[model samples]
Target: MDPFFLYVYRKLKRKCTKELPSCSLCVRLGKTCDYDGAASEMNVDQQVLLDRIRELERQLEAGSGGGTIAEISAFPRQGSSLVNPTYTIHRQGFASNLYFLDPESFGPAGVPATELDPGMPVPEQVRFILGNRAEVETVTESYYDTIDRWFPIVSRKRLVARLTTFEPKTDASVALLLLCMKLVTQILPHDENPRTGLYWICHQFLMQVEGAPLLSLTLLQATALMAIYEIGHGIWPAAILTVGNAVRLGHIMGLHDRDNAHQLFRANSTLTGREEERRTWWGVVVLDRIVTMGTYDGSILTADVRNHELLPCTDSDWDSGNIAPFGHAFASDLTGIQIGHWAQVCQAAHALGCVQRHRVDEGHAKNSRLDEAQQLDRTLVSLAASLLADMKQRGDMAINDPKQTGSRSSVDAIALCCSARFLLYELYACNDGKSNISRVSSFPSGQEAVMQRISLQGINECVNIMHQIALRLLEPQQHSTRQSPESYITYHAGSIFVTHALYWAASECSWIVKEGINAAAARVMGDLVKALHLLNDRWHRAGDYIKLLEREETLSD
Candidate 1:
């Protein structure tokens, strides 16, 4: 056995296991395999050939030196076991033969010549393929903020524009608007005043659209209803003022063009059905009433006095009082609850005024209005308690109602329920010695017991109603093949209302539970947030669909 051969054999076996053959020139050239046959076969200078051969020999000697041939035989050449171990091929019509080693001579099948180096898990060669962390973060944050800020404004604008014009409704603009409103309401706290600019813009658009004058009724009523909410909590006096001005404008327009107004109203009334029309008509009347109460001093009192006479109720009705009519008509499901709640609030206000007058007459106070105002505050607390109970009962029924359409009416119902809940909180605060009146809790020791006896389970029930409504609205509706534009608009608007109700429920959860009762408020809030995100995503997809449709139309044109 030759020592040099043994060393070479050992080196070959080691290379088969854990290394790959390296050519210095090829390595320097940054190429994988060397052109060994090309160098050998090419006609070149003898010196160059000898130099290459010497270099190869020198590398071999360095790799394997001073080992015996017997030891080499023991060293295991990679291809020693095979019967036909080598293959020969002729080079270019010449009898020169080339020998090749079999790939299996190396290691097990599919094993690489060398293992990956653990020190550098991510190699410098492929490091650049990974993205920049900071850039990714920056882009993500910017993308989210852009969506958060711009989407609401854009959606609202589109909604106002669509509603202003009678477009063949597809579930695009209205759905987008509802989703935006829902998100905004959910993320923003209740006490944080909502921007009136959007509402004002919508109102202005509705006013300008020339058609059936009553076409604006829904929008107007929605605005006024929101205003009532703000006024109830003593937030956004400007909104109250704006609503008052708008009502005045509506009155002026309706009065001067009586025939046209009457004709349009009649037509709209006929279209929407007697109940909805009456609800809307009374909504206008209520808006007017609210404006009068908010703006003109003694106007609310006088109006109440007149309404009391014009639409008189039996004493039993007021006292049987399990739940007061609150207003004249309690037929239609839409406005019945609303009218009831508003009337109760107004009645409470009137009672407070009376109490103030009585105090002044007894010479107990110089500012008689102040005393009456205090009493009114107490009445508000009581009224809120009663309404809370009624709402709870109604909400429970709504949840259990087998025939509930889960439509826009349902959304409105949830909205009213939430509104009632908030009013209860406000009234509770007012009666807690925080605002207008002396603390009802401190009045008589028994008063606390009486007030505490007021059922708050209704708040929980209302929360549940809101939760269910939110779920229903967020659910996609199966559209009819020939659904009307108005129906589409109505559906979208209802979705928005549903989303808003959920948002309200979520936002109010902490406050709702702060009174020491764990209700569905928190769960409802979570559900609403999830539903809103879903609805927003859907709206964006719908918008893209509309764009595609428009593009197709343009191409057709």
Candidate 2:
């Protein structure tokens, strides 16, 4: 036996006070565990473990015992340190310090994790991950940039008139309506310039389309539900603006128009079948009316205070039985990108409303319709919470499913990243009394403490999810030579989403909760920014490649 092996064996023997064998790495690493292997293999493992242990020990000594190895290795498993001291195994003869571990080895039960193959060069593997992330970021940036650049140029008046000419059959009319809404919403926020008048003209043109059928109950319900979330977060201004537009459109189409508009609005209201949808729509309409009423009285929306629960989801009799279930027109799987818009709107509302909760039915005149709005708000919040929970559960199951043994699809990969970001926001935004309620009430000390706990939990989850995503994107899989460009694009987009989500979350925390985020979150944001810059460089390079390919084909022809 090698002398080192003999020394480790003696140490293990001394540590083994019972019949069960002791782990060599634990003994050498100065932790506790079980070891079952040849002495040389054990020695090799111990040396690796010892290197890490020594590094940690030095860190602890430098920090005057304030820093611990336990803190460094806190993730992937915390309490189980005694049983699974090292959850990962680095590839044999690989000089780099990267470790490959089964995703299942880390975290709470049922949380998702990604597995990495052991053969690839660690540096190349990391680059591969970064490349995918870069691609996603590039695509997202392009999408935003395109929207920003072309929006000012789009002729809203002509577009609205064009929209009016097409009286579509079936449920497609909602698409046109939504398009009109999108144009207005995007332009309305920046309407100070002279060019904004064109948007108003366009808005007027769309409003001229009488009896425009409310198509896609799913979309209306989704939008309404999102509005409720905003109201709950005390982002009354945006909630008012968005829902007010919907109400104005509904009323204009319902009451003022000469062409069967009232019948169409009635039909649309009746079509929403889900109890949740009915509640959300009613809540939005009632709230819109209340806000309008208050504005008419020259009072703030928050000035009125009544019990919101009086208006329950069941208050509406609008024949919700007629609404169809979600269909092919709506995207399946609820991509994070799609849901992201709703989250953004909700956050924007929160910022405008001073992060306060309000009583739903207080101070409204008789038949004020505020009760319906409150019910809708509650229902939408419940729906969002449920959706988030389901996504988390599904992600965990998908990761562990025996049949899902192959690499993840680009969509699924991106979805996972989005889901993680969603959870992070929930951690900061959801259930925080200070952030959730209206300004009339101050958060108690206990509530503040709870909010901090929730933020910490969310931060921990976000960091872990980010790590898993990074590993999956960067690390090589079996039988694949290099990651596809699509993978790069997806990863890049996902990283951008994560970066923006963090920035928004941090900003919200600083503004509402006053609980400063730790340095790690800031560090992660910095890394993501650097990653974006790198990705932009890659995108430019890829653009060159594409142009070269096109020119080559042209020359060949």
Candidate 3:
């Protein structure tokens, strides 16, 4: 693209004889050449392009040789815009900014001043987190059975081993235990306010051991779990901080550097230990992508980390009581059926990030962007196809099977598939810029009609899937029941999923209404409202959706 600009600049600068009021070149080409004050701005744009082109050429030349590329860095630092800055694309004619990767800060970090004032000993903290022996057994069982599948970083066997020892007061161990108990005590179907006290103590413990001298695998695991717990509770700022810390610690320990385990950790590290670290690192990436959805919070796991290794093993492989050496990449012998839903979620996230990076580098110029979006759409479709095929091959996890429907991981994989499709829709549909509710203003006839068609298809699929998810949320056996707190972290990604789809539908309601799709739009809205209402009983934030619908109704009235 830069080279093309340079070529145009060179052609424009060439001296040509004038014929009448126009330049000679214009006359020879039978075209108009009315250069005015705008020519100076064109020259400035050309100069910027030339500089960028030269830098890229230098990087290319270095890559051709033995040296590394000068432009691309393996590990970008925290808050570095170059890592992956949020790109804002203006709607061709609308007032709202179309953001691809907008940064989201949850505000200031730390617990209440008074809350941090008092510090209890590890023994008291342990007892506070777990009241009695029976309570300890219950919390442990609950976490392993219900919550662990989503982010299986902590080893149940290892944790049980630690518990058997006398008062193991490590920061990571304590943080992990506190967070698990907090989730169990808070998210279960009940109206108990007693556990918030335990949640605060856990927060205090995390703050106390935050700046410990040495970094351990356990600490990273704890930090990742803390982020997950905080995000589930709608504590965005704290979740952001903990996830950031976890990613930073991961980089320092070279967790993402492939095949460098011995160099970073103990020389005698077992295969199981190495595999555990890999899963934990990937878990952080999953949480990072999940929590940062819809906002421009730059992802903690950069492309560099993703390229470093293969995904973790299947649940069956991990659960089997066999010890074997794991490879640096996904095993070719393992069929797609063996890959877990969590791995599919990671792939979806990675694909979304790639699309975002492409958008940032290349502005929303219709021609190439449509092609790229379609290509990404194909890739995402292929991923979904693979997941479906895998599910069929397994037989037990059939798409419509009642048992599979209850599995949180299965639900998450399907939701993420919907998310990827919506991303494709948003990429192309954003530029239409028509916001008036009275007319079908976007994707007017004859302008990139192919893109408009693809985007419309994406929208249709997204809305349909949203309706399915809403129905699933009403199921009696879903993890987040009417009586339980909304555990958005586990299987309840529907909260964010529905909100995103609902906003997209509502924003375009005027256009759809004008196009005689009012009935469909109303149905989508009704389903979303029903799902959110189910959550509203226990999750305070769910009420926000109800209020949004009310405002829309008022506007209509």
Candidate 4:
């Protein structure tokens, strides 16, 4: 978008001409005109769009009287009250954000704080929140600052605004959304935290809300948040189940299909809604693919969505609600395209899906599998190079810019690259005696040696990156008594997002150490073991990695 027009629309309180070759202002100023930004409707009257949406929604609710949700399919049918709830699109600027409010710190570790009654009535839950408004605001703020910073699925500004109103009580979906955020952000060190008591409360509420006839955007967002919480806390089949719920909901809502969303909205929806759906879908994709990595388990994601979806806007554009239209970017349109950190992560997740679903497994020729694997290897190499280079250039991972979505830790997006590389090479890691693709010990030939060399390079880079992260996370000569793994993730206590990537790298490292003696690989493994040990108390996946690494260490002995 034109900076002048954005300022004029946002600050000067004027309508935007939205001219293509520069607005009249730019033409008069004799500036090179460009209007490369968010939806054309953005600079227009947002209230008008909201009013239209509200009217359409009212019509929808009126058409469908009332019904109960069945089989988790909340789609509306003829004469059914199961409508899609559209919360007021968050276009009210930074007032949507509560940064100006006095943020009282509300960590879960403390007692003698405002607490919620577990048996509070469904509608009465909002009262608990209103009574403890400061605490609610603090935890929501913490979510944006830590967990949401790197893997932002929902808008903190929108949630903050929703919390201040009656929406939570009126909308069961909104209530579930708030519960999921509080569950994730507040319940740390799960054993002793009083908020852990709310886990079952939240889960039960989710079960009831999931069956609601009205499938609100807030419901989908809630499921996604709950999935993140379960995944991060290493909650077993619950994590898998929650991820499936979110992914299936995203698919049912046609979030993966840009044209489908357009059809549903029918010309009145703005980029704000599209961007929200985009981020929510990508968040589910990241979770879905990451969970299924290195496992035979199939992905809940349906047909490849590369050609059908638009990647999220840049971090700054997304935060300020300056999101461009779908024409700005499509997944297929972005090859080696440097857009934003999360966009790159989306691309990486796509690569992972490609690796898992590669043609190698089909009853094709060995040469076909080999050729496709090489292509995948090149894709990952290019991807890892782009992400690592940008991360190195960008410098700090603390995210000093206030315009930034949230303060992210170092492992925000880069770890997925390592994971993709390791996964791509895992099938080829078998002995050359058994397979022609791998030539680690046996004599090398033309194409096989070249592929082997590339595979080893990718493998080594995984260790190199993991070693760098472990070193960055663990200070030199610092007292190593780490009862808290969250603090060990970054220089400070940043939320953990990529422990699965760490586990994958450790598996590859263990294979390396078990197969032969690589001094550098072994040293990296040591750093990883120390880091994993700290993380074990928090994430079950990390603890598993520690055991796997130790078993490899024993074999090396």
Best by lDDT: 4
Give per-model TM-scores. 0.34, 0.30, 0.64, 0.68
Worst 10 residues of 3 by lDDT: 94-103
Q: State the lDDT at 29 in candidate 1.
A: 27
Which runs of model 2 end up more than 4 angstroms from their true locations? Answer: 1-201, 207-243, 251-389, 392-500, 506-519, 527-557
- Estimate, for each residue in 409-527, the C-alpha lDDT of model 1 and write its tens digit: 32433354354343333333345565533433345444433333342444455566567655554444333443432233233323322333454455455555455456655565555
lDDT of 2 by residue, 1-557 (tens): 32223433555576433234655555554554534432444554565566566757665676554322122321111111112212122333221112113322322221111122111111111122123434434533443333212111122232234345533332233333333333322211111331232223222322222212122232343344334333322244665675655555434322222233222222232223233333333334334432332231222232221222112211112212232343112211233432322222222222212112222223444223223323323333433344434434445223222122121122222332333333323423343345423321243445534544544555455443443333333333323354543334322323212333333333322322223445454444333333333322322222222233335442121
lDDT by candidate, in order shown = 0.35, 0.32, 0.51, 0.57
Q: In terms of TM-score, which candidate is stronger, 2 or 3?
A: 3
Error of 2 at 46 (Å): 89
Per-residue error for 453 in candidate 3, Å, reads 1.5
What range of 10 consecutive residues in model 4 has the weakest lDDT sum?
110-119
Residues 1-557 of candidate 4 have per-residue lDDT tens digits of 32223333454353347687568864443233435644444332453444445556655675553343111212222222212223212122222122114212322121120111111124343335323567657766766665666676786556656666834345456666766777766534435532244565567567655543334567778888777677766677788888888877765445666453311122225667667767887888888877776455354454555565567777777767677665345543355455766777777777777876772355555566678889888777877766666665556432222121124433546677777777766556554566533433333355566667777777778777766665555542254465554553422332344566666666666777776867566677677767665555445556655666566564254
The C-alpha local distance difference test score for the whole of candidate 1 amounts to 0.35
Judge candidate 3 against the unseen true structure and give its global Cα lDDT, from 0 to 1. 0.51
Badly placed stretches (over 4 Å) of model 1 are 1-242, 250-281, 285-410, 429-441, 477-504, 511-521, 531-557
Displacement of residue 48 (Cα, Å) in model 1 is: 89
Instruction: Give the better candidate number (1 or 3) by lDDT.
Output: 3
lDDT tens per residue, model 3, 1-557? 22223434555686545445887786553334555523334454454455455546655775555332112312113211121111111123111111112212211221222222122223333444455556667777766655565556666656666666524333334544545454533552324332254445455545434432223567677677666656544565677777777777776555666453212333234566666777788777666655555564254454434454677666655555233465335322233345665565566656656655654544565445556767877776676666556655655244454233334345456556666576556655644455211122333445456666777777776665556556566554364343543443334433333444444444444356546765676655565666666665444344554566567662252
